[model samples]
Target: MNVHITLAHPEPTSFNGSLTYRAETYFKRAGNNVTKTDLYASDFDPVERGAHYKDRSNKDVFIPLGEQRAAWKNGTTPEDVRSEIDNLRNADLVILQFPLWWHGPPAILKGWFDRTFPSGGVYTSRMRYDEGYFKGKRAMLSVTTGAPEEAFGPGARGGDPATMLWPLHYSLHYLGFEVLHPFLAHGVQGHGYSYEDHGKAECRLAQKLDSWEDRLAGVWNEAAQSFPGWPDWDHRGQPLS
Candidate 1:
């Protein structure tokens, strides 16, 4: 399969960085084409402001969604946003590799969603949800967390993984990706806060890398995470009665 890996961490030597590298190497070795979008290395600008739209529809009033729609129609999309869109268009499977910061994706990745997913270009009101632009493609997250596994549960201190991940997963569903179960690596503390010796952490990380490879081997056969779509919603956007 053609795969695209988007890395959000600033440091290329970080755990999240290693995960993206491993994914690229594993897939390519398996004879699949892989593309890497290292957001930091590429110096991706995360903030979306009025300046991005040079051909603004209303220069005085900067409406984000309106500007995006206009930019897409005029083919005046910023080079960075255009590049990401192109990569996603060609990929069969898209993997987002990042560390969980404050229970969500980094500013870079979130801004990626904000900029790359042009309102009129990638999706429309009627063409969203299950019927989104990337209907046939697959997407999943490979995340790292600083907390231990025991800390995450329905009512744990680290917060429920499922609940924390819902907004992002739902966003993918909105764009028509067949979202898969996220691959999480817990107990991944940074240098100063590391709970284990350096050697032990390296060993654990190596083992996790192996597990990631195994997951990829069966990715195609895996069931996607189910989400409610138009069929399940009413005129008021509530669940159908």
Candidate 2:
């Protein structure tokens, strides 16, 4: 399987970076083809400009977005964004590794979505709504949190992680991907957790990955059964399929 791992942390030696490294190693060791996108190290542009709007009607309008996303799936896109897109497009699974800063993905990763997920870039006009270009893909989040797990519960100070994660879950679900439960390492930076704690964290993360790997693959295969079209339903209506 082709798995794309996108890292969003800015610091090279941070715990988030270490998690990404371990994830890559694990996936590769599992016999899957792994591609890593270090958004910060790549100096990716996070700002969208007038050019993005100017070429809307041009025949090559989708070119830039396509180039930016080329590497995502399997190197099928052209040399530009194609690498990133190919990585996304051809992957059997996509693992997003990042720190839960301010309760969401870092700016650059968010920018990646903004730049890549255009109306015609990934999803064609007809395929909008329930159907998306990335339909049938499987995605998982591996995040590191500075706060302890206790702070993320239903009645805790930080509130439920599920609530904090709704945007990401809904986005993937809207794009027709299956959302797996996130793997979170809490209290990584807090007092009492020593350097040796990282080893335990790694083991926990590995166990989570091992437990979900087959289930995620199953979800991807199931997602592929649907046509690339919106179902006959509304927000208040029941799911058609």
Candidate 3:
């Protein structure tokens, strides 16, 4: 299978980056074609503005969606975005590896969603949800958290994992991917941030890496997380009774 891993951590030696590397190696060892994009290492611009669009559809106002539509139509989509899109186009499974910062993804990864999935090129009103362009593709999030696993759940201190991850999972669903249950590694404190003994923390993290590899072996056969599709919603997007 073709796999694409997108790493959104700033430090290449970070635990999040290690997960990305492990995934790449796993796929390659299995004889699958693996590709990767390290957003920080590549210095990917996460901001979307008029600067990205060379040939503007409207010079007076810079509407992001409008410019995207025009660019896709005129074949003037920014080269970097186009390249990222091409990577997605070739992948059977797309893994997003990132740390949970401020209870959400890093700005760079979010911007990848903004730039890579062009308006007219990837989605339209009629082409979203179950009918989105990437209908047959699969996507998963491998998230790392600083708090312990016990701190996350409904009514927990770190906030519920389901609630924290909903926006991202829904966004992938919007693009028509079969979104998998996220793989979460908690207690991922960096130096000087440990809640427990440093030696114990290191040992736990090492075990988590092994667990990650084991999970990947059967990732394809796992059922995707349940999500409301077109059939579940009315024309107004409310849940059907």
In order of listing, the candidates' clash counts read 0, 30, 0
For all predicted structures, in order, the TM-scores are 0.97, 0.71, 0.97
Cα displacement (angstroms), candidate 1, residue 88, comes to 0.4
For each candidate, what is the lDDT?
0.90, 0.65, 0.91
Better of 2 and 3 by TM-score: 3
Q: For residues 124-189, what per-residue lDDT tens digits would candidate 2 score against the true structure?
A: 545553566676677877777777677788878876888787787666656666566777777665
Query: Sort by lDDT, best first: what order?
Result: 3, 1, 2
Output the TM-score of candidate 1: 0.97
